[model samples]
Target: MTAPVLEIALLQVRPGQTPAFEAAFAQAQSLIAGMPGYVRHDLQRCLEDDHRYALLVWWETLEAHTVGFRGSPQYQEWRALLHHFYDPFPTVEHFVDVTPGRLPPS
Candidate 1:
């Protein structure tokens, strides 16, 4: 089986917009959750900076997110709901496990 891919996005919301951005994300989360090959996701706020967040998503493969999710119509809605809240916009990247067996059990 192909190893899963991890998507990471360091988001910086415009100052004073964190509350609204988080509300929008609550609605947008379902769009990603229903996509093909989606494993799981999490949104974590930074303690040092209230305007910063980390978005992590696990997919069955790279294409499952880069192609399947981002290319879908749902992504448009996802953008509409959450994109405006970003200041400079977030950079998204993907990764594969270098030591899969080293990960602690969930």
Candidate 2:
């Protein structure tokens, strides 16, 4: 099946809260990694704007992301741990990878 593409936001925690945010994110990673159909994930820090960050997650299908992941217990943990880090929950969008690059080797 063709994979679904999702853009995730890595909420910018204020400077002093970096440690707290990282610690929580580290804890959530294990749970997220265990979910079904979860293909891969990447964390990126903004080079031009240090305060900004993002997560890119690819799934085997949209259901794998919205229903499988978002509705699972792991998602609860993921949200509880990470949601607060965002000053304002950044926007989330989905798109097709028409001219995609090489699939990342996990």
Give the top-scoring candidate (lDDT): 1
User: How accurate locally, in lDDT, is each candidate?
Assistant: 0.94, 0.75
Clashing pairs in model 2, backbone N/Cα/C closer than 3 A? none
TM-score of 2: 0.81
lDDT for each residue of candidate 1 in 1-106, tens digit (9 for 90 to 100): 6668999999999999999999999999999999999999999999999999999999998999999999999999999999999989899999987885676334
Off by over 4 Å in 2: 100-106
Per-candidate TM-score against the hidden true structure: 0.92, 0.81
Task: In angstroms, give how far residue 2 of model 1 lies from its true place.
Answer: 3.0
Off by over 4 Å in 1: 100-106
lDDT score for residue 38 of model 2: 75
TM-score of 1: 0.92
Which stretch of 10 consecutive residues in model 1 shows the poorest summed lDDT?
97-106
The 10-residue segment with the lowest total lDDT in model 2: 1-10
In order, what is each prediction's RMSD in angstroms?
A: 2.3, 3.1
